[model samples]
Structure formats: C-alpha cells, structure tokens
Target: MGKSQKQRAIRRHNPMRVPDTHLPKGLASASSSSSKNEAVLPIIQKMESPEVGERKWACVAVSNIIQNDPSTRRLLQGKNVVGALIARLTDSEEEVVVEAMGSLRNLCIDGGYDICAEMYNKNILTPLKAFVPKISTTLEQYLANPKAAPENAAKLVYEFADNVITTLWCLSETSNKALNAINALQLVPFLMSFLACRDRLPLAPVTAAAQCLYVLSDDNEPAIDEVRSNGEFITSLLAIARTVSDARTSHGKVDIRRLQLGVLASGVLKNISPLPLAVASDIDIDKELVTMLLPVLQNTSLRDATARVPVLLSEQANEVAVDKPSLKNTPKSDHRSPVEIELESIENQLRTTQLALEILTAACATLPDPDVSKHDEEADEQEDEGMEEEEIDEGVNDEMSVEGVPSKDEVKSSVDLLPSLVPVLIQLAEPTALSFPPLANPSIHPPTTSALGAVHIAALECLNNIFLSLARNPSSTVQADTVAAKGIWDGLWKSLGLVGTEFGLGQERRKQFWELAIGVLWGVSMVWKGFLAPDAQEVELLKLFCNSSEDERVRVKCIGTLECLAQCPTAVDGNKIIAEYLFTLLPTDTTPPAGVEPAIQAGSALIDIYSDETFPYDVNFRANGYLERLVAHVDAMKKLVKGIDRRKPGGRELRLRGEEVRDNLVAFLKYRKALKL
Candidate 1:
C-alpha cells in the first residue's frame, strides 16, 4: 500500500518528465501551433486566388502584415505592391475594395510626403478621393464620443489632409483644374465641420490649419482679400475659434480659449485689412465689440506672444476707467465722524490696498516710454510741402492743423492708469500662489505669484517701452536718467531673493520673469557700464547682490548682468568687478537657485566664457586669475564623481552636482591644458 501511494505521488508530480509525442499534453501544444498556422494560412492561400473577395482580403492581409509586422512591412517599397493595391481599388467586391484602400492607407501612413507625392503624380489620387466618404464616416464615429481622443483623430486628419492639400496644389499649379477640383475642395467642408465638433481641432489641426490656410490663401490678385472671404464661406470657423480661445477649461491650462480668441482676432483683422478689397459701406463690428477686441490685442499678454500691432484707427477709450477725481481731498472737516477703531477689518483692508498702490507706483518707474516722438515727427513732416504755395495761402489751414500732437502730459495721463491695472493683474496671480490668503482679507505679503512674477513682467515691459520712448525723443532734452534706471535696478534687486524654487511656478511665468530680469539687467548694465560712475549707494547695491545670500535666480541675474557688464563699452574693469565674488555664490558645481535646468544652463553659459580657449592668453594684458581658479575648482569636483554609481537617491544628488562640476571642470581643464606654462 505504501509503494502504491508513493507511485501515485510520483506520477502526479512528474515535474521534469518529457511528454510522449502522441500524448494529450503534446496534443494541446500542437493545437496552439495549428491555430496560429490556420490564422496565417488564409493570407497566403488567397494571395493569387481568382475569387474577387479572396483577392481583396489578400491585399488587406498583406497590407496589415506589412503595417503590423516589421519583417513584412519592409517588402512594401518600389515594387508591385502599390500597383496591385491601386488596381484592386477597381474590384467589384466591396470588402476587396475596402481592404485594398485600407492597405494603401497603411502604406501612405509610413510613406510620408514622398509616397503621397508619388500617388498624386500617378493620378492615383482619383481613387483615393473615392475612399474619402468612408474615411470621413469613420472620423465622425470617433468624434461623436465625448471621450474621443482628439489628438489621435487630429493626426489621422492631418495625414489625410496633407495628401489631399498637396495633390490639389500640384493639380492647381498645372494647367489642370485651376477652379474646379471638387474632390479636394469637398474635404474642406469636412475639416470645417470638424472644427465646430470640438473633437476635430487638436494641436495637429491647429498646426495643419495654419499651413493649410497659408496654402489656400496664396492667390496673386486680391490674395489677402480672398483669404478673408473664406470666413464668409464658413462663419462657424470663427465661432468655434472664439469658443476655444475664451475657455479656461480646468485650473492651470493655457486658456486655449484665449488662443482661439486670437485666431478669431487674426481672422477678424484679416477681414478688416487690405482684404475684401472694399471698405464696407458699414462695418459689422459695433463700437463695444471693437472695445472688447482692442484690449485683447493691446494686452501685454498677447502683444509678446502674437506681436499684433494695435493700430489706433481712432483712439479707443479704456473699457474700465478710473473716473477723474471730482473734488480734491480736503482737510477733515469738523463734521467728520470720530475715529473708527471698531472697524479694524476695514482699516486692515485699507492698509493692504495702500501697500499694493505703493508697489505699483514703484513698478511704474520701470514702464517703457510712449510713442510721442513718432507722432511729433509725423506732425512736423506733414507741413504744406506737397501743396502749391499760392493754394496754401488761399486756403484757411487753421481747421486742418491738428492741435500739437498730444502733449507728453496727455500721453502720460492716458497710460497713468496702468499702475492701477497692476492690482487686477496681481489678483489673477493670487489664486495660483496660495501663499497669500487671497486679497479679500488684509495680509502683510502680496500674492507671491501675481505680485512677484506678474509685476516683474509688467515692470520689464513698461521699462522696455520707456527705453523705446526715450530712444524716440525728438528733443535731446529727454534722456534716460540714472535715477529712473537706478529705481528699476533697486526694484528688481528687492524682488531677487523672493522668486524661490521653480517647481511650483508656471513655465510662462518663469519665462516671463527670466526674460524680464535678463532684459532689464542687460539694459541697466548698458546704462551703468562703468559701475565706477554710480554713486556710493549704487555701488553698495551691486556689492550686496554679488555677495548676499539671496535667491538663486537673483544670483543668476547678477551673473548675467555681470556678463552684460563685460560687454558694455563704458565698463572699466568689468571683468575685475565680476571676478571678485561671482564664483562664491554661483559655483558651477552646485545646484542653482530653484535647482531648475535653465538655471544650470545659465551657469554653464557663464563657465564657457571662463575657458582659456575662449580667452586665449595675450601677454600684453593682465592674466585673469579669477577665471583660472574657477576652471580649476570645477575640475577637482569632476574627478571625485567619475566612478560613483548614481541610480539611488544619494547617487542622483551626486549626479546633479557631478553634472555641474563636470561641465565646470572640463571647461577649466581645457583652459589649463591649453596654458603654455
């Protein structure tokens, strides 16, 4: 009985035993093999079949195999496959035709423009068009679902559109069908309809549409006008764009809604301009829509991104205006109520408001100058040079003489309200910061995101405009004073250490701040080239920025400013000034302020300048020891991390440090190696 049980256990557990060929275990494995064979058998079996349905399936199977299987797909080129697929499009069997079309689509998928171009050249596009209704039907099915993958659909549509658009262009370029290419133009309606559907206009379509619009808009006579008229054909395109541009979607996404608004703006502007060839007897846009749209173009947000020129066809009024003070603030009257300590809440809010007002006042010192000079130049140039002297003498020119192009005071007053608008832009930044508990309650700190970054951007822009205005000054009387430039430098310095880690910041905000800081400093560096001439206080401020334990971006800015300083014509010993302390705070081997990649790039840019290859030795000039030491330190650090493993957290920190160190070391070593001594 023990032996029998042992034998049973052995039979049940036969883990290493090989099965007999004819046994059920082997038979099951054989069945799997047989099924795979059957799955593949049909493809090859039908390849040369006389049956129409069989032939179509063969074309599809080969196409699918070529598309899905790497080995088979390689066989699709420069051969009978394209010809065979094209011929099968004429097959009577529907399945055959569909499969053939599907295979051709697959070939075109990977083939890109060359194959599409080839197909168009071969007049193979005629059959391709026949398949569009089928493709569009499929596209519509995908679009109907609320959860449709908009991106995937866009790619497919772009592919189809590319083939069609290119084909149409080629056809149009020739003597063939300059006007009537029904096959190509019909697809335009499908694309336009997709724009309305919301699921159709993904990033790819936005890109494709830009390209497609340019292609379709290119006509010789009234070309711009012809493009504007397209809006008339499909008015809903503008409507969809408007809807998308205005939408903010969930928190933190780019207001694609704003983008669509710009497209609408562009389309509208196109319609207004050189296009339509005739000024409308009456324009469709009312004054209010004009008011709403003009601000968008005027907004600093769109100006930098779109570079739209906000032409004042006529001077438009500000939408939300601060009314002129009706009466001056009078000394408290005897009738005034007693002090209201009970309303502490009101007092705190008032204090907060006053603080914001002060910041804006300080920020305004940075804004760019207005275009007064250009206006003045035009005003001076238009003097009766063209008119006959006798005719000019006979005419009463008093009515035609414009009141001296708006005074500087008038321009300043018109834009003075900009400081007031700073708060609203700050309010937009507050929710993102979460540092300040919103603007409703009184707080010591302003909203960090809005006040720090947004204000910085606005300040930079205003400074740019101010500089531009100064550049345009007709009179040598107005110049960029050190006081104004100093105020800007001080303001930027105060904000320097405040911009912390970049992880929580938006890319646009970060970019804006960096750009503003770099630009302003570059300008300031130019203005104060010889730091030698600045007052004692300005020199002290420079010293603090270089040596202080401030924020990293600020340090980065200082380094950048120092680099710019190096370029200034008036800079005396600029290299000596920067070389003294820059290496201490912004060591190339360390993780930079915010520890962001861009900060690292900025550091690398500085180190590159220190290399001897960059600054080859000229014995006549003093040797730059500071640059030499910086290179040496980077080298020692690089050698220490060379053999260390870096997959773990400790390793990662090492790698970050190691990367900076390595770049610095390599740069330094390269210079050191190049030294003759």
Candidate 2:
C-alpha cells in the first residue's frame, strides 16, 4: 500500500493499536500470526533501513505479529523486534514514528506483561520523552489552523496522539517504574486538553486520552491529586459519561458509538467519583448528577448487539451491522458524513455495561431503605428526563461544560429499584449465547465472549452485593426471609454453577463467584438439599469435581460449597436431608464406583456421610455389605493413582489427589472395615 493508503488503513481499522480496550485473547488468528514470523530477522533488518517505507513496513509487520498470535507475542519477546521498534520512535520520518509507536504500543498490550518489563528494561520512555512533545507541538499547530494544513494532516496528529497516549497507558498498567516516568512527563494536562473542548477534536484521540487518563489516575496519588484539582475536567468527564457523543448513525438510528463514548467517559468518572475530601466542595451538582446518571444503572438495554454492529469492530467504520431486522427498513441518515463517525467497539460496549453494574453495586451499598415500596411517577419522570438530550450540535456545545459534580442527597426512589434491576441483572449474570459475532474458527466461544464473560461476572457481583445488602438492611424493601428470595434463588441456582463451569472466564473469577455463592447461599442450601446435593440421574458438583477442564481451586470451591452447607446451622431437617442425599451417591452392595470419576465421586460422598453430625448411624448400613463397598472405593482410588504419568501438565496434581482420596478412605477403617457403626 502507498503511504496515504496505509495511513487510512491505520485510521479505518485500528484494531491492536488502541491501548486499554484490548479484547481478551485478541481478534487475530494464532495461525495467521505464526505464519508471519518466518520473516522476523528480515523485518528487523528493514527496521534499521535508511528508507522510510522499509522501516514503516517493518514496524507494521511486527504490529501484525503482536495482534494476531499470542504465541508469536511470546516468541518475539526475546528477539530484537522490540529494540528495533524502540529505535524508530525518533525516526526523522513522521510515518515511521507512528508505525514504530504503534508496534511498541501493541507489544505492551496483547504481547503481555513480560513485554512491558522488557520495554521498560530497554528504556522505552527515553525516546518517548522526546516523541511526546513532537506530537504535542504538531497537534496544537493543527488545532490552530486545521484548514491551512493539507488533507489527512489533522488525522495524522490525532493518530499520533492516540498511539502515544495508549502506549504511555499500557506501560503504566504493567510497571510502576513506567508510571513514575510518565508522571514526570506531566502528560495529564495534555490528556485533559482533549477533554474540555472535544468538539474540534476527533473522537479517536479523545477516547484514547479518556481511556489513558482513567488508567493512569488509578491508585496514583499524584495523578489523582492532579485530576481532583481540575473540577471542570472532572465535571466534563461526568457529563460526557452521562450523555451520548452523537445521536444518530448514518442510517439515522441511535448510534451505538454514541453509547460507547458515554461508557468510556463514565469509566473515567467511575475511577474518580465519590470524590476525595480536598476537592469535595469544589463541584456542587453531585446529587443532581447522580440522579441523571442513575438511569444507566437501571438500563440493561445498553448491551452490545453484534448483529447491530460489526462482528469485528475494526471493520465497523466501513460497515454498519445491518443484521438486525429492525435496522433493515430504517433509511440511512444522510445528515452526517461518513467522516464524522468515530470508531467504537463491542469490547467497549461490554466494558461499559460492566462498569455501570459495578457502579450500581457500590451505590446500592450506600443506599438507605426505599422511602416508598414501589417506583412512582416522580422517580420515573426524573429517570426519563434526566439524561435524554434533544441534541448538542456535533460537539460539547457548552452543555457539556458543567462546573462541578458537587454533592447533595440522592433520589431515594419512591418505588423499589430491585424489581426492575434484578431481572436484568439475572439475565446479565447468566452465560450469553449471542449469534452474530460467530465463534472463532476453532475456538468454541465467540470473538466477544471474554468481554461478555466480564459483563456476566460484573452482574453476578452486583447481584451478590444486593443479596447481602438487602438481607441486613432494616429499612430495605428487598426481604431476604430465611433464604434468598424465591425469585432470586430460582433465577440463579443453575446459572451460578454454569458460571463457574465456563472455560473462557479466568479461574480466579470463577473461584470468586463460587466463594460468593457459599457466603450468600449456604444457609439456603443447608435448608434445601436440592441446591447443593447431586440428584439420582445427574450430579453437577460431582461431575465438576472430576472434569479435568476445571481448575483445582475452582473444583475445591465447588466442593467447598457442599462442605460448608453440611456444617451450616439450619433447621433440624436440613442435616437429615443432606445425609439422605449423600447416602444415595455412595457405593452400595450392588453398585461399586464404575470408574475413576465414579470412584472420586463415591469418596467425596463417603466423607460427607461419615462427617455428617445428624447422619442416621444405622447398624443396617454396615450389615448391607458396607465393608465390601468401602474396599471397592479404596481399590478404585489405588488404580486411579497408579494410572498417573507424573511428567505431564496436571498429572502430578491428579496423582496427589488420588492418593489423598485413597488415604481418606483407609482412615474410615474404624467404622468401615470393622463394621463397628
């Protein structure tokens, strides 16, 4: 491609370059990335070329490697690829600089933590120190005289800004040393420059700045102090988050990008909000802003419909996702030119939804009991009117320049918010099965599933918080009787287990979800064996325990749910119900464990049965070949242990667990082989 054409390609499809908004596992195929690496040394040699085209092409090729295959990302870490790109940051040619910065920015991203540490070790910020000011100088010049410059000049400035800001943000995300270096650069004000008068700026750089500022401000006292002092900046962020970027798409439909922009803006506010003590008095409209923004908290309609937007959001600028039947008949909006819309992604939409749920969870934690038991006309009116704007030209238009987000009391809804909130949250908490994004070629999950998984986890977290908060709040309308509300319990029981079962989600998230389940649901499970116990035809927990796919901690958590339920203090019948359930899964005279899985299952049930405080210790149990049954379980575990090849990935852990189960069985000899019970 020619230079101008290449710049447009960078503009129209900037998948890997935009810092923090990376999709989990990335969008490129592993095979595609792998195939590109055969030319690594040639590319590195080209990167040192005197010719701008060769150097730029080299950088672009390295970026392609970074984006497509994580295996290649790992492979490139030890090579001269990163060092070669860092050298191009100061290249006399602007295109070479852009390409090099883009390649290095991406390396820090999907390339993973080791790459960031590598960049830091290479002293990346040294070249970046000079590079930041160069972009700043050109950007200001363009803003001063946009029309005077040739076409694509301003776009180049914005692209430069996007790559630089995102690169800085990615470095800070992984290493504190890089963050300190960035802070020394004093880039916060420059980042804030994109926020105040965003009308003249392209949305791409503005979103990049917003995302970077949000990330850099986190937990850094110096950055937070800088952010806190700028009340107008804070208020503008809140307003942008509260309102849409633009009202319509080319088709005159509500632009999905508009919602995504608000989400990005809100994400910054989420980091800074419930403002610190020093600047607390400066911004005066806090409660009003909360009232305005609260509706997003209750609105579940903001979910990304890949059918309504492109499957790969990089292609979104060139194509409108017209897969939805509703969008089919809608006439295309001719008002805004194709040049006007900024890039937005399904990843952004998912992140936005998760942020809203998370904010609501925090808000609900502080909420007083409902003043009224049902939502009334007044609360509904505020919700309806608070955020729906008529329009704001093509930019901030003065309406976005709020002076403050100062505090006052919140709008305690006249009617309960939970009835409306819970159902949507329940839907979010479940595993999503959206059709349009399509599963990646070989992977079973869709391109957007990791993002969706985050939304689901966020919804569950919010739900868990609601459960505990309402249960204890004396004035709260959500009545947690002795157990979860009938509706809440019914909605979550199956999905909760399924959430822990999803492979796409990190095991830590699944572990956190399971632990939260026990904390909130154990009382109910102890009361109702159906929640924790395996049934006649199938067993969710037992199968999960044996399924090799599940992480050991997650499996421990799943089984931990049962172990905790058995010991929980509930009604007298709770223990009896649990004991009867355990006995059914244990080995009997005719039914020894059929295989390794069944053997593990039998051992787990035996432990619970032998340990149950209220277990009906029947002499008839041992009389019915109980000793023989114990021997069978022990023998099964022995075979399970002998079968392990300890050299394999999980084999050692499997062998250890098998031995542990066998030992636990033999430890039961007093009541088992002796038949003394």
Candidate 3:
C-alpha cells in the first residue's frame, strides 16, 4: 500500500478517539453543551466504569475541566465527583490514582469551606490516612537500598507522597476536623520525617510537608505540643528559614519558593510553645529566627507603603484644587500600578513579620519572672560586700550588683534583635500620609488610617517583652546610644501621644493602645532609672489623657503610667501631677465608683514617692500644696466611708478602697511630719 493509504487506514482505526457516532442523540446535540454540568456528566459516569482505561481518561478529563474552568468545580462536587475520585485513590493503576488525587486537589483549591466540609464528610481522610503508611514503607525500603531502587520507582514514591500532602494541606486550610484527624493519625512525625529526610527531596514535597505542619499546628494545642517536643523538627524548620532568608538576601530578589519556606517555618515556630528550661540554650534558635525575620519585617514594599502618598494624589501632581469633588472629576488613574500592587499583595513578608513577633512573644513568656525576694537578698549581699571592699570603685560595685536584671548572656540574647525591630515597629505603628503636599484641602484626602494595627499590636507586645527582659536583668544594660539611635523611647512616646489624640479610634482599641503604651513605659522605667521621669512631655501627656479622656479604661491606663512615673525621684513634676489628680478624685461628692480605682492608684503612687528618702520632700510636697490636699483627702475619705452600706454589692468594696487611700495618705502625712517639712 502507498504511505498515504497506510496513514488513512491508521487514522480510521485509532483507538484513542471515540467516534461521536456512538453518542446518545441527546448528547450528540450541540444544545447539550450549554451547561457544563450536563456536558460533563457522561465523562464523570465513565469515572466509575469497569474498564481501567475508561476510568483513567475520566479522571484526567475531570481534572482538566476543573482546572480550566473553576465554575465547574461546584457542579462536579454536586455530581459526587469527589466520592468517585476518592474511591480511585486505592486504584491499582498508578496513573489513575495520580489523576484522581490531582483532580480532588484542584476542586479544593478555590473551593470554599463548604467544599472542604463536603469532602471531609465523604471519608476522604480515611483513604488519605491509609495512603501514608504505604508511602512510608516504600520510602523506608528505598532508603534501605537507594542504589538498588529504580530511580523511577523512587520518583513515583515522592510524587505520590507530594500529592497526598498537598491535598491534605488544602483540606486543612478550611477544616479543623481534617487537621485534627490528620494530626491524630501521627502525621506530624511522618511529615517532620520528610522535612528531615536525608535524601535531597524536591522543594515541592518539603514545602508541602512544612505547610501541612503549619496548618495542623494552628489552634491545635496537642499538635503544637507535639511539634515543640520534637527539638530536631524545630531545629530543622529554623535551619530552613535561615537558609531561605539568607539566600534571598544574597540574591537581592524575592524568590516565592524561599518566601513560602520562610513563612511556613516561621508560622510553625509561632505555633510551638516555648522551649523547655532544660533546653533554654536553644534560645539561640529563636535569635537566629529573629535575625532571619528582620529583613522581611523591613521589606522595601512596606517602607514604600509608609513613605508614599496615595496613588491618586501622586498621579495628579499638577492639579492644585484638593477638594473631593474636583478630584472626582479628574481622570481616573490606577494610582498603584500593577507591579506596585503585586508587591503590596505579596503578603508573605507581612506574615513573616507577624509570625516573628509571635515567636518572640513566646520566647519572652518562657523567661523566669523577676525574683523580687532574690533581688533584695542580692542587694543586701552587695551592701555587705561593698562595705568590706570600701576602697573598691563604687561604679564597679554598682555594675556588678545591679539587681533585677537577668544574667548577661540571657539579657544579651533577648534584646539582640531589639535594635533592628524597634524602628520597623515604629514605622508600622504610624499612619501613612495621604497626600504628598500634605493635603492642603483636607477633604480630598483625610488622614489615612494604617491597616497594620495587628502588626502594631504585635510589635508593641514584643517590645514589652524586650523591656521586661531588660528590666529583670539589671546586669544587662540597654545602651543610651542604642535607644537614641533607634529612637526607641522617642517612638514609644510619640505613639502614646498619637493614640491619646486619636478620637476616631474605637473605645476598646484606644484602651488597648493606652495599656500597651503604659506597659512599655513601666518596662522601660524599671530598666532605665529616670527614663520616664525626665520626659516631661510624656508625663504631661499621661496626665492630659487621664483628665480629659471619657473612656474609663484609658483613664485607668494613664493613671497606671502616672504611678510608674511617680516612682522616679527625678520626676518631681510627675509626682505633683499624680498627687493633684488623686486630691481631685478624693472629694466625696465628685468621686464616682469608677473614680475610686485611679484615686487609689494615685494615693499608692504618692506613698511610693514619699517613701523614697531621696525624693525632694520639701520642694515637691510641702511647697506644692500636696501635703494639705492629702490631709483633706484623708478627712473626706473618712466621711465618705461612713455613708456606705457594707452589705451592698459594691459598697463594701468602695469603702475598703476609700479606707486604703486614707491609710496611704495618713502614712504619707506621718512621713512628711517626721521629716519636719
């Protein structure tokens, strides 16, 4: 036969293509193609056919349809495509199982929670869990004699394992049931084994395994505890994060793979509980993680977001009228160009920053609380030694015995990242500008609110941790130069002022902000004596917020800050401000039930100030009418307590608080009289 004749014969007998001539009349009509669901039903029915080839083709077809058109996913789900595919997971044909798993993964990709919940209800996890032991046994056999194992067989093992982990990861994204079920099956150790696999596995499987672990750990305390207990696993994750971060830094470009690895590792680290005391030395792991995360926190995109004006304003550079109506008439522009928008949307960096902060918070939580009794004993021991070594340099003696600070190594490790973290935190806390020329007409662009409130909260919490670590470790010193260079204290004070003035903030938000600011202040004061005292503006801001803010929570936080400031002898103005506020609250007719807390706080603060022998007794108290107010407050409290019913709900508590204030005032009065002031 001629060559063309032979080709024609081959085409006529092709087994791959089914002749349309065999289709039912309904399916043969073009009208049947209008609805994807109706058109795909025949192929889906083939998925359960007895013929292996038919089933494989059906799986491939369904995967392609779901991949090409997402809308068909819901239709496929309704048609029980998941049940058919999940059944094929145990199919003898490798290609059939691969296609089935692949199709299910695609369905779950953009499938909302309902799809996942549906899949979970269909016993998809039962097969997935069953597949793990097979893969493990295969991987073990391959590892036993890698050279004897066919390369293709090894590759197939990894491929199946990757698909399984990926599908599980998708389900985990929306279903805690899947997460807990997988975790309960001891999959964490299996996945961690993959991470620590000696053979150089492809990034796909490793990344999938890490991500699965991350999702599993979320809100699952048992999973978290499991991961934490596995020190090797934690170490492997940190190593991966460091390697990826360093590689990205060296390349000076963002690799999505590296970003994904770093984010997943940090996320897992964030979920794990703090390291145990026996493994306290592992804090270096945390330090390394922090080092890896610093670059991400300082991502250039966030910096650009902070520094740039709104895109609309930047595009309208030549326009002068800043009114909203005028700006609306201006031609529309995509202020953030596509590339900038993509950069902004790359949320891995932000997620990394948040995760880093959480890890640091956990690390700080593990530190031993400061020992007040130990501090006193240490002070007494230091005084005895000081007298014995009278000729010893006083400065040297003071440095050696600074009470409340942690050991030098502990302190150093904790604050190692503070210098890098503090500045980025300050930037995140501040609101971005809306216009380049400062918005001459306010209506065009009112003040833009920062969307990074969570980041700010995390940063503040981390800063509080750093401060506490430093304060408790009196032997550890925060260099004045370091604080000034980073503008750490300055930024904190500015944040306090900004939050205090922000009237648009929700009551709860403002209260939280104030509480964090005050806590940070207290932490700083404990470490750096007179740090709060010398900042008159900060002290005044606290006072202003206390007196003017209608939110009782804000007022309470401000009063707490005032109490902290009053403890510093150098803060004479702070003491006076606190005393005056207390005196005002002391008047029985003016004091509300809510007022008692702050008033009592103020009285305790005054007692602290008076008890300090170094306090300027005559100048701050006697001359400032503080003493006279104390006497009148004591008298007023005594009168007020007489009218309260002891059995009433809050009356006894109020009376008790009032008496405590009077007792504090009476003690202060005695101290002042003994001084002959």
Better of 1 and 2 by lDDT: 2
Q: What is the C-alpha lDDT of each candidate?
A: 0.40, 0.54, 0.59
lDDT of 3 by residue, 72-101 (tens): 555666577778888898898887887788
Please give, for residues 1-677, the per-residue lDDT of candidate 1 as tens digits: 00011011111111111111211233234344332333344545564578875785567555444422222333343334566666777777655665565566555543433344455456666775665576567666666763765765545554554444333433332322332443344445544444454444444344333323423333322334444556543345435434533544577443433443334333333333333434333433322233333333233231221111112111122323233211122112212122222122222222222222222222233222222234333432353235332343212234222222434653353244333342233332222232222223322322222233333454454443333323222222222344544555555544433433242212335434544444455445544543413333434444454345235445555455555444333433545454444444443455433333224433453454344333322221236554456554553344444433444434433344456455565755566556643
Kindly list the per-residue Cα lDDT of model 2 for residues 234-270, writing each as its tens digit: 7677677666534357785544455655665655555
A best-first ranking of the candidates according to their TM-score comes to: 2, 3, 1
Candidate 1: residue 388 Cα off by (Å):
42
Best by TM-score: 2
Highest-scoring model, lDDT: 3
Better of 1 and 3 by TM-score: 3
What TM-score do all the candidates reach, one by one? Answer: 0.30, 0.61, 0.56
Prediction 2 TM-score vs. true: 0.61
Clash number for every model? 18, 8, 5
Candidate 3: Cα lDDT at 668: 70
What is the lDDT ranking, best to worst? 3, 2, 1
